[model samples]
Target: MEPCSSPPLLSLGTATTSLSPHPKPIPTPTNTRLAAYYWFLVPGDVFNDYASLADEINEWWWFYDGVLINTSPMGGTLIARGYINGNIPHTGFPLVNLYAHFTY
Candidate 1:
């Protein structure tokens, strides 16, 4: 299987905002799931900070297993990917391929 080319669309919640300062917040389109996928260019310090955060989360989270951390083939990039497999808290259905990604 390949990594996802884009983020998954989640219908969690919504918020409204207006373009101008004086106008009231317009209820633009609600109930829309927006997914944004792009590459972020960061300075060395910021990159290091993200890498450290990923490491710390992976280490502290007991639910993670077989987490993979590496760089892209082109170099100068970092990829941290993993998945969680188990049953939902009260549901007996098997949960699989629930993955997470951290890249820079």
Candidate 2:
């Protein structure tokens, strides 16, 4: 008789980070008739495969996101938005970010 062998198991994990650069100087809005707030939504996608559990592994890759929101004077609403992609080559490694903001 022969002994049975055990099969290997696999596992996967994911992580995310945010980066906001300094906001350029802009004219301050002077409107109090309405409330104001802003929200920057940046979408970054990750496509990688994990290996079976054996030794812990950690690596960083290049990814990008955009900021989209309204100015403080604009009632803090979402207006025009932009994006970043791999095409925009960055000379840095995995942990980098930038944000822009201003209020009245």
Candidate 3:
């Protein structure tokens, strides 16, 4: 992932840090935590499967080189398809920012 600090996404009309994904509330945490804060969501666990994560998302953003190039309910499906087909342009580091929205 890139640094937590990033250029403003004024289009959203909100102030946020990349620390939280999309600045939306989640219905439940992978585990119960006070307010289900950002850090409470589970990180890399060998048990997490692709289908579960994919189905859990309400929306997401696809960033290339730290810039959001596509989004959910828009280009989200295409982005996921591209990734599955080995078409996403990931350079150097394979991990991109997680900018997803889960139901709240």
Best by lDDT: 1
Per-residue accuracy of model 3 over 1-104 as CA lDDT, tens digit each: 77778777666655575555568875775764322111111243222223323232322322233334323444232233212212223223323223333333
Q: Pick the candidate with the highest TM-score.
A: 3
Candidate 2 per-residue C-alpha lDDT over 13-102 given as tens digits, one digit per residue, 9 for 90 to 100:
353643449755798778634321121133432322222111101111112122322223233332222222222333233221222232
**RMSD values, in order shown:** 23.4, 25.9, 23.9
Better-scoring candidate (lDDT), 1 or 3: 1
Candidate numbers, best TM-score first, in rank order: 3, 1, 2
> How many collisions per candidate?
0, 8, 1
Worst-scoring 10-residue span by lDDT in model 3 = 33-42
lDDT of each: 0.33, 0.29, 0.32
- Flag clash pairs in model 2: 19-97, 19-98, 20-97, 20-98, 20-99, 21-98, 21-99, 37-76
Error of 2 at 35 (Å): 40
lDDT of 2: 0.29
Q: What is the clash tally of candidate 1?
A: 0
Better of 1 and 3 by TM-score: 3
